[model samples]
Target: MEKFTKISGIAAPMPMINIDTDMIIPKQFLKTIKRSGLGVNLFDEMRYDGDGNEIPDFVLNKPAYRDAEILIAGDNFGCGSSREHAPWAIKDFGIRCVIAPSFADIFYNNCFKNGILPIALPQEQVDILMNEAQKGANARIEVDLEAQTVTTSEGEVISFEVDAFKKHCLLEGLDDIGLTMEKVQAINAFEAGVGATRPWV
Candidate 1:
């Protein structure tokens, strides 16, 4: 997992609610468990046409938003099935932060586990970010995870709330595996003691 202390980059706006996992990366793409290379297939259905051509109108396909690293989404974002792939695809696409009016509980937690910051804010705040994202290449957004604030293109500062524990994990790049590794020495010592004491068993 990568540390997400501060992120400043392009933000793509997707104002659709109830964006489920299937729409993010179809089930066909789920065959591989790897997280890399999922970016090309992120929002596969929306990005491609029937013939597999890029959809010109989609925000991600547009030249300006092609490299967007943040997403300003609508209400009820990340709804439906609890698929970890959704966060994988978003992260693989270089998006580290997502701001929305609301998000599904499972998906929100998944984001934190995958090194993606899922921010839930009031509708007004999200609306402000959405407007900033509309500027495309010219506009950039800044997310200060430590400060818990988002700076829009117009120099507007919007504050958000996040769990302190989750913030600590992201700042230190500590996922479940990373967290476990932190106690490796202690774990090893404990195992050694257990083996010696219970050798007969």
Candidate 2:
């Protein structure tokens, strides 16, 4: 996981609500456990047509939003199954932050674990960001994780709340594995003691 301190980049607006796990990466793309390749398949169903051609109208496929690092989405974003792949795909696609009116609990938690910032803001604030995102590549949005604030292209600043532990993890780039590694010396000492005492077993 990469440390997320502050990011200022293009934001793509996806106003449709209830964007579930399947719609994000689709079931077929779920075979691989590796997280890297999923970016191309992020929102696969929406980004491609029946013949597998890029859909021109999809927000991600549009030229302006192709490199968007933030997403301004509608309410109930990431609803449905608790597939971890959703956040993986989003992060792999280079989206570091997601701003929505609300999000499903599982998905919201998953975002933090995967180094993606899932921000739950009031509907009015989300609407403001959505409007700014609609301006395309020129309208960059800034998300300051340390400050817990989002600044729009026009300079409107809105604050958001995040869990303290999750915030620390992101700032330090500590995922579950990274967190465990922090106590490597203690773990090694414990294992050595156990081996010394229970070698016969």
Candidate 3:
């Protein structure tokens, strides 16, 4: 996973609540295990019409938000099934952070694992960011994981909380496998000793 330290980019406003996993990438697209290429299908139903043409009114379909790296979503974001593909699709779309008043527990944790920051802020603060995001490409939001702050284009700063351990992992680009790799030398030594003592096996 890529390290997520600080980022400044377009912020897309998605105010709809209860955005489940299916709405994100859709159940039809869940056939693949690979994470890449899912970005094209992100928010499939909302972004496309019955003929699969891009909808003009959708936030992501709009030119300004096409490259948005952050999402200011409504409450209960990432609800429903615990498929890890949701975060994969978001990250693949170049969205490094998701800011909402609240998020489903499983999805929230999965974000960190996939190099995405799922921020939980008060509704008032999220609304403020949402307004800023409405300004199209003219407005850019900055996120600092170390400082735990999200700064709007107008210079308004809002702080959110994150677990310290997870923060360290993201900063260091350490996923579950990366974490274990940190102790590779010790693991190798222990394996060697076991082989020496149990050579008969």
Candidate 4:
């Protein structure tokens, strides 16, 4: 996982609520366990038409938002199944933060684990950000995990809350595997002691 300290980039606005896991990457793309390459399929169903052509109206397909690194979404974002792939696809697509009025508990936690900041702000604040994002590529939004704030292009700042432990993990780029590695020396010592005492076994 990459460390997420601060990011300032384009923010795509997706006002539709209840954007679920399936809508994010679809079921067919779930077979692969690898996290990379999923970005191409992020929002696959919405980004493509029946013939597999890019949908012109989709926010991600629009030229201005094609490189968006942040998303300003509606309420209940990431509802439905607890698929970790949702965050993987979002991160792979270069979206470092997702700002919404609210988010599904599972998806919210998954974002933190995958180095994506899932911000739950009041509806009014989200609306403000959504409006800013509508301005396209020129309007850049900045998210500071250390400051727990999101600043709009017009200089409006909104503060958000995040779990302390999760904040630490993202700042240090520590996923579950990375966290375990931090105690490698202790783990090795324990294994050595066990082997010395139970060699007969």
Candidate 5:
């Protein structure tokens, strides 16, 4: 996973609530275990028509939001199934942060594991960011995981809360495997001792 210290980029406004994991990447796309290449299918149903043509009105389909690295969404974001692919799709799409009034517990935790910052802010604050994101590419939003702040293009700063341990993991680019690798030397030593003692087996 990539380190997420700070992100300053375009924010796409997605005001619809209850955006479930299926709506993010769809069930059909979940067959593969690989995390890469899901970005093209992110919000697949919403971004394409039955014919697979890009829908003009979808926020992500719009030219201004095509490269958005942050998302300002409505309440209950990432609700439904606990599939980890949701965050993978979001991250693969280059969205480093998702700001919403609230998020599903499993999905929220999964975001941290996948190097995506899922921010739960008050409704009022989310609304403010949503409006700012509507200004298109020119309006850049900055998210600082270290400072726990989201600054709007107009210079308005809103502070958010994140678990200290999660923050550290993201800052250091440490996923579960990465965390385990940190103790590789100790693990190797223990394995060697076990091999010596249990050689008969």
Candidate 6:
């Protein structure tokens, strides 16, 4: 996982609520376990038509938001199934941060694990971000993980809360595998001692 410290970039506004995993990557795109290629398929159903052509009206397909690195979505974002692929697609698409009024517990946890910052804020704060996102590439939003603050293009500051452990993990680029590696020396020592004391067993 890549470290997420601070990011200032374009934010795409998706006001629809209840954006589930299926809508994000679709069942058809789940065959591959790899996370790299999923960005093209992110929001596949919404981005393509029946014939597989890009929809002009989709926020991601629009020229201004094609490179959006942040998302400002409506309430109840990431509801339904606990698929890790959802965050993978979002991250692969270059979205480092997501701001919403609320998020599903499993999805919120998955974001941090995948190096994506999922921010939950009050409705008023989210509304402010959503409005800023509507400006597309012209307005950039800044998310400072260390400070736990989001500054809009107009310099409006909003504070958000994140768990200390999760913040540390993201800042240090430590995923489950990375965390385990931190204890390698201790694990090796324990194994050596066990072999010396209980070789017969």
Tens digits of per-residue lDDT for model 6, 117-153 = 9999999999899999999888999999999999999
Model 3 regions more than 4 Å off: none
Model 3 C-alpha lDDT per residue in residues 1-201, reported as the tens digit of each score = 799999999999999999999899899989999989999999999999999999999999999999999999999999999989999999999999999999999999999999999999999999999999999899999999999999998999898899999999999989999999999999999999989999876
lDDT, candidate 2, residue 66? 92
Name the lDDT of candidate 3: 0.94
The TM-score obtained by model 5 is 0.97
Could you tell me every candidate's TM-score relative to the true structure? Answer: 0.97, 0.97, 0.98, 0.97, 0.97, 0.98
lDDT by residue for model 4 (46-151), tens: 9999999999999999999999999999999999999999999999999999999999999999999999999999999999999999999889999999999999
- lDDT score, candidate 5, position 138: 83
Residue pairs whose backbone atoms clash in candidate 6: none
Clashing pairs in 4: none
Candidate 4 positional error at 10, Å: 0.4
Give one digit per residue, the lDDT tens place, for model 5 in 70-118: 9999999999999999999999999999999999999999999999999
Per-residue lDDT tens digits for candidate 1, residues 1-201, read 999999889999999988888898888888788989998999999999999999999999999999999999988888888889999999999899999999999999999999999999999888888988999989999999999999987888988899999999999999999999999999999999989999876
- 4 or 5, which is superior by TM-score? 4
- Cα shift from native, residue 58, model 6 (Å): 0.2
Q: Each candidate: what lDDT? A: 0.92, 0.94, 0.94, 0.94, 0.95, 0.93
Per-prediction count of colliding residue pairs? 0, 0, 0, 0, 0, 0
> Tens-digit lDDT track for model 2 on 7-85?
9999999998898889987888878889788999999989999999999999999999999999999899999988899
Q: Indicate the worst ten consecutive residues by lDDT in candidate 1.
A: 24-33
The ten-residue window of minimal lDDT in model 6 covers 26-35
Q: Which candidate leads the pack in lDDT? A: 5
